[model samples]
Target chain A: MNSNGTTLRRIVLAGFVLLVTTGVRADGDASPIYGVRMPEGYRNWQLIAPAQEAAPLNELRAVLGNDIAMKAYRAGTLPFPDGSVLAKLAWKHVQSPEFEPASIPGAATTVQFMVKDSKKYAATGGWGFARFIDGKPADEAQHQTCLACHQARVKDHDLVFTRYAP
Target chain B: MNSNGTTLRRIVLAGFVLLVTTGVRADGDASPIYGVRMPEGYRNWQLIAPAQEAAPLNELRAVLGNDIAMKAYRAGTLPFPDGSVLAKLAWKHVQSPEFEPASIPGAATTVQFMVKDSKKYAATGGWGFARFIDGKPADEAQHQTCLACHQARVKDHDLVFTRYAP
Candidate 1:
């Protein structure tokens, strides 16, 4: 099922490339996406780091919304706006980090995303891994490597740790 | 509360720097946080990129599932785990492409997250420029400056993409 999705994605990217290459350019069609007008008060904002001392629980709540994570856990699957294997994979990773059947059934191994923030933008998201199904402790390499995705964020949120300031 | 927390994090970081500079070692008295142990299946867990042909919806789902992006979106604030203001700033840029916040009340700007599949992860989080609030476009400089933080992700997930594989 996952592989099929991958195939589909490849086809779509190919189509987009073709479209961009072969498209007829209207006068207005060439406008840069970056130049699109934004709503009012957008520039008044500056990126401020969330405080580190914020309660982890509050942080978690602000990000995941206590309701969403718990509901997904209870249901055994987390659905997204789009129907894709990536969604299933991310859902499984969050449902159970260990990658056990009981931990996260129907787990896949790929996900992707790009993040945009105020004036600057950053991209991250990555594979979830567990060295053993029932191991006493998850390996450091796996965990740290997972963190490597957000390492650039260290200067921002202290190594990808964000304050769930509500 | 938030300001105080930020101050504490600064102190902790300073102390860590001090310890590292002094070369303070545990001298065999320290224990691993999770009790270090190497596991057998470490090699079995491999990283896989998402399908290149994924549809727009698939890409969107992937972006929405991003742990970092989603957490910030759901919480309606910048959560900084690593205590880096730069990262938080980068996040804001990635979270909202429009440079304005529409979904979040009191928010001054917006951020957008796009998956490797080219799906949009746009959200209106707090903080932004005043011009954006009045509904105008941000300059290219603001959008272009985000590459430094995002560049770090180039090797792992492509410059503009990240993985959320479960």
Candidate 2:
């Protein structure tokens, strides 16, 4: 090949590699689980459910979803379609002094997310899970527990606990 | 007073001082503005409205309120009674690729709050304002702008912008 043609071909190949790497990273990290980033604008997504937990983890929880997740939730589609994303925000539960006996939120504890991509997260039932505390990613050990708990309890509901509040 | 009686009185006075300081800090900082904390369980509070802003500060915002605020909103009370607390959570806006043309949330931008206490905040039109970004308080100059904008644009609505969605 001519010198200029060779140089052009090499540049194109390098560009292709960079593009692929960027795409992979954007989808998620290398781990089977904990690959999902906190999905964009998840708080504005439709509310799937709200929950309160007692005992060791006294938390007030809210589950929200992106468009694909909301559509699947409303339609009752199982094995949720690709591009579906769910975010669960949790806070420590406190008592409302102004409204005696009523519970209120304390400090925020965690923000967890699940992204459904059948091909990408096929091992973990086609879903990638992640948890963040104050916007920082949780460790791998913590991430492992997410799949185990969901698989054991809510495997039937596509390994999800919250139902569509609507 | 006897020695034991004097000691008891001193202890009581110290306790009272401690309690008062704690209460003041809880309601807000020393500044007239930026005193409100993210009210406990605000995410679980009733959602009053959801909004989107364009350009410069493109954001998706959700407004949530405590029981007193929710009741007042439902009852259509104009002035919003004392004990009402409203939280506005905003995030960077992004597009949902799965559902093209629909916007989704990116990273969170701020969590702002308005607290009504007629006796306490009578100086600022019965409301105290605060803004936090990533859990840290915004500066005094930024906080001052909150009341100015609200007083100018929404003075009639008691300095609130979002109407109850229901």
Candidate 3:
């Protein structure tokens, strides 16, 4: 793009290769207990915020929200409504060959989702959770830990870890 | 969100407030020659990439693309199509008191755009550019420089600088 091409939170896409490196769906869908399927068009969703993980994970991630979720976020609605959906896309952080300080999303590790359906998921505080690796749903036991993690942590903010990033 | 609460490109919004610090807009709209105006519902655009400025600018900026722009990006379409539009949202970078390593978007700087209209902006490579501060367009002299700047740099990438950050 030019010197300014050096620009976007920096533009590093190398041509048409899109999404994660190991991104072929295995035809399996939906987490076992919660039955939450991967959201449609989740990749096109707007960002709620960017996040980084430390130590073993050492990942770069972003949380994205569906339209209803975004509307709630923009309005600062504390208790999200029935249709709220959040997707967390995570990739292993890799050192940039070109820039020393920058780390790019490399080898996507997971795609997780949090869906809100007050009556549908009352056991998990009005939310349903799912995690996928290589587009395949992880084990039910893996999903079982999602609510436990959210409850132990941000039970106050409706189990959403991401705040809207301006 | 618990310790994970420390997550998103890190969560810095103090509360429910969203968007730029100086977000209020006046009656005047659209740049003079291009007649390009602030896009409706642009805050919801998807992120293309994130960029940082050095020295005097010291800013954190992200480029956003509307549906058309996103399609072009996802498809790796060089010389973005006639309907493509890119929005660059800039903010001054400020230190985070809680985390020494993290910096957050501080004061609002400027919002700039490159709008594509093949027939309308034929002179500027089918793209019309606009810059706004506090929702007001800069002077015509300032507008005149947009083409010259882009031409000197990323004229090769259809004058677009961002790549879709997966």
Best by lDDT: 3
lDDT of candidate 3 at residue A86, scale 0 to 100? 92
Per-residue alpha-carbon lDDT of model 3 for B66-96, expressed as tens digits?
A: 8889888989887788778888887776664
Give the CA lDDT, 0 to 100, for residue A14 in model 3: 30
Off by over 4 Å in 1: A1-53, A56-58, A62-166, B1-106, B113-136, B160-166
Query: By the lDDT metric, which is better: model 2 or model 3?
Result: 3
RMSD of each: 25.6, 22.5, 17.1
Better of 1 and 2 by lDDT: 2
Report the Cα lDDT for residue A161, model 2: 72
For model 1, state the Cα shift of residue B58 in Å.
31
DockQ (C-alpha based) per candidate is 0.02, 0.02, 0.09
lDDT (C-alpha) at residue A73 in model 2: 84
| Segments of candidate 3 deviating more than 4 angstroms | A1-27, A50-60, A91-107, A138-145, B1-27, B31-35, B47-61, B91-108, B138-149
The stretch of ten residues in a row with the least summed lDDT in candidate 1 chain B is: B83-92
* Per-residue alpha-carbon lDDT of candidate 2 for residues B41-128, written as tens digits (9 for 90 to 100): 5655666655555467766566788778988998999799988888877776565433243345667898888888888888888998
Per-candidate TM-scores read 0.20, 0.47, 0.66
**Docking verdict class for candidate 2:** incorrect
DockQ for candidate 2, please give it: 0.02
**On residues A41-71, what C-alpha lDDT tens digit does candidate 3 reach at each position?**
7888887766555557866566789888999
Q: Given candidate 1, what's the lDDT at residue B70?
A: 36
lDDT of 2 by residue, A76-160 (tens): 9998998888877776756543323334456778888888878888898988888888777878888878888788777888987
TM-score of the A chain in model 3: 0.82
Quote model 1's TM-score for chain B: 0.23
